[model samples]
Target: MLFLTIYPKLHVVFALVSTHMADEDATTTKLRDRSHIDNTLRLTTAEPTPEFSAALKKLQNIYHSAIKPLETAYKYNELRTHEVTDGEITSKPMVLFLGPWSVGKSSMINYLLGIHDTPQQLYTGAEPTTSEYTVVMHGEKSRTVEGIVMAADNSRSFSPLEKFGQGFLERLVGIEMPHKLLERVTLVDTPGIIENRKQQERGYPYSEVCQWFIDRADLIFLMFDPTKLDVGGELATLFKQMKGRESQIRIILNKADNLATQDLMRVYGALFWSMAPLINATEPPRVYVSSFWPSEYAADTNRQLFIQEEVSLLEDLNQVIENQLENKIAFIRQHAIRVRIHALLVDRYLHTYHEKLGWFSDPHEVFEDIVSDPDKFYIFKSILAKTNVSKFDLPDKEAYQDFFGINPPSGFKQLSSHCSWTSGCLIDNIEKVISVELPALLSSLGKKETPPPAKATPAPPPPLPETKPKNRWRKD
Candidate 1:
C-alpha cells in the first residue's frame, strides 16, 4: 500500500491511499480508482475564488444594463448577429470539433473525457457514425435530450439554432455526463463533412450553420485524416468561411500512427500546401499530428513526438478554462461594436428614406432597394465613408433578404420609421459599454486574477522494474 499527502498554507492535510495486490489486474484497478478520486477531489476543492465570482456577476450586470438593451431596441436580433442569451453568459467555455468523415472527431472527445468511469457517450466508426451535432456537457447523471427539447429548454444556449429550421433541429442532440473535465469545458461534435455533398441534400444551409458555431466557439479543432489530405468539396468551402478566425483554429492531422515517420513529414507538408489557398492567414495555423484514441504505437518512430504534441494540445485546453471569463467579456465587446455599426447603418437608411420621399412614401420599397444594391446606394456609401467603417463591417445582405423574405413587409416598415438610434439612448449606452464599461471591468479582472504560471513538461516517471508480462494492458 502507498499513501500520498499534500498540505497547503493552513497546514491542512489531504491524504489518499492506493492498495497494491500481487494480481496485476487488481493493481491496475486500484490505480485507476485513485486517479478518478484525485480528479473528483481537485474539481470539488477548487471552487472559484470570491473575487472571480463577483467579477462574473459584474460582467453579467454590464451586459444586461448596457449591451442587451441596445441589441433589443435596434432589432439586432433581426440582423445577421446572434442574440446573446443568459444561458450563454453562464455556460462554460465551448470547444468545437470539425472535420470530414472518419477523421476521429468523436473519438477525440472520448479520449479526452471518457477515459475515466464515463462510458463513451459518442459513437465512432470507420464510416459516418455521428449524424447529428452533439453537445457533451456536465450534469448529475447521464442522459440524452432531443434537439427540439434541448433548444426549447431555456437553461441551454442552443435556442439560436432554432433558426436553422426543423430539419436541423431534428439532427441536434445534447448528451450529459457526470465527468470531471466537462465541468471545465463543453465539447461539440459536429457531423462529419462528406465530399461532393450539396447543401440541398443536407436540407439546411450547412455552411451558414457552421459559421454560426464558428463565431461562438472559444476554440476550434479542424481534424484531418492523413489519407484524405484533399480539401476539395465542402471542406474547401468550410475553410473559406473560417476567414478572420485564424487565431481560434488548430489543425489536427489525426490518425498519424498509420504512416511511417518519414511518411508523416511528407503528409504534413502536403496538408499544409493544400490548406494554404483556403486559410486566409499569412501564416499557417498550428497543426498537431497524433491519433487521439487509445492505441499502441510502439513500433512507430513518432511516438515521442505524438506524446509531446498531445501535451501541448491538452495545455491549450487548460488555458481556455483559465481564460473563460476573459473570453466572454471580449466576445461581448466585439458584439457591442457590431451592433453599434448595424444601428448606425439602419438609422442612416431610415433617415435617407424620410428625406428623399415625403413622410408617407413606401418605406418597404426603399428598404428592398437598399438591401438589393447597398454598394450603389449613395446613403450607405456616405455613411460608410463618414463613419470610417469598412464595407465588410456591414451585416450580411443575404441574411436580411431571407428574414424579410419570409416575414411580412410590415416589419421593415416598422424598422424604417422607428429609427431607434436617433429616437432613444440606445446608441449612447452601447458606446459607453464599448468604450468605458467593458474596459474598466477587464482591467479590474487583470488586477484581481493572476494567471497561472506556465507548466513545464513533466519528465517521464521511472519505468517499473522488469518483469514477465502477465497480461496485455491498454492505456486508459
Candidate 2:
C-alpha cells in the first residue's frame, strides 16, 4: 500500500513538471515571434508640424544613439522606444466621443463635419449600431482604411492597436474625409458602452484598449441623452480613469430638445447629482446642452441656448490647434519620465546580477570587462535563475531571453558596451531636454518677457565706532 500511494504521487508530480516545462517552451516561442514581428513591422513616421518635427528628431536621435544600445547591452526587456517615437512627433488634436447607444454621438460628429448628404460618414442610428472604434481623420477624399492596413501604417496612432489581437482589429475602422474641421482635429468614435454582463464575455480586453486612447486624447466628450443618463458598469470604470483629466473632459447632455423646459431642468439636475460623485469634481464639468442640427425630430424650444452651446463647443475644439505645441511638449516630458524610470530599474538589476555572478571584485569592473568580451555575457543565465522578480515589474523570462538571447558572444559584448555608453549619454540628454532646454524654448515661443533680475540690497553701513560708550557716560 505504501508503494502504491507513493507511486501515484510521484506520477502526479512528474505530470505537473512536464506541463510546466511545456508552458515555458510555448512562452519562449511566443516571445521570439513577437520580437520578429516588431523588427519586420517597423512603422513610417508621421508628418508633424515643423516645431514638433524638430523636437521629435531630437528625441529620436537620443534613443537611437543612446537608450537603444544601453537597453540592448543590459538585456532589458521592457523596451518602449517605438511607443515613444513611432507616431508623428506632433500628433493632431484628438477629440474622443464616448457614450451609450442612441446618445447622438455619430450624429454630432456628422453635423460637426457638415456631412449632411454623405453616406461615407459615420453610420448614425437610434440603436447600438456602431460596434467598432472608428477613427476619423483629414484626407484628400473620403475613404475607409481597413484595420490591417491601418496597423501596417506606422505613421498612424492606430499602429499600436494591432497588439490587442485579431478580435479587436476586426472591430476597428478608419474613416478619412476632406473636411475642413478634420484638418485641425481628429475625431474618435468608440463602441457604445453596454450595461449588460455580456460585454465582459467579449474575448478582447475592452477597458485596457479604451484606457490607451484615453491617455493620448487631448480632450474627451462624454455624451448622455436625457432619456438614458445612466453611468454604471463599464462607463463608471472609464469615468474613474479620468480622475486627473477632469479639466479636459466635457459632459454633453444630448436630446435636450426632446424634453419640455421644466423636464430638461429636472433631467439636467439629476445628471449633475449622479455624475458629481463619479466625476469627483469640486466644480461640475461644463455640460453642452444642444441637439445635432440634422436630428431635428426632437427640436429644442430654446433655439438660442442650443445655437450658443454648439458655437461654444466648436470654438473650444478650434483652440486645440493653437495649443498643439504645448501638448506635444507635455507628452515628450511624460515619455522621458517613463524612459528614465525604466533605465534606472534595468541598471539596478544589471548591477545586482553582475555582483551575484562574481564576474569581478568590483561591480563597475564587471561592465567594463563585459564590454571587452560580450560573448561572456551568456553567464547572465547563472544569475537569472537566482534572481527574484515581481511579475508586475518587468517582462518575464521568455521575453527577456527572446530579446537578449541567441546572440554570438562577441556581438553580445559589443552591444553591452555600446548600450552602457549610450544609456549614460541618453539619461543626461533627456534630463537637459525636459528640464532646461524645452522650458526656455516654450517660453520664447509664448513671447513672454523674462522678469528683470532683482537688484541686490546693499549691506548696512558699519556701526559707528565708540558712540555707545560715549552715550552711556553722558546719560549717567
Best by TM-score: 1
Give each model's clash number.
0, 5
Overall lDDT per candidate, in order of appearance: 0.71, 0.62
| Most lDDT-accurate candidate | 1
lDDT per residue, candidate 1, 105-205, as tens digits?
98778767744324644776665677789999888888887999878877787878888889999888888878777887889999999888778888877
Tens-place lDDT per residue, model 2, 268-382, is 8999888777887776777888766353333337765665565556555544555666676677565555444445444444544455557346644554455344336543343
What clash pairs does model 1 have?
Answer: none
TM-score of 1: 0.79
Model 1 scores what on Cα lDDT? 0.71
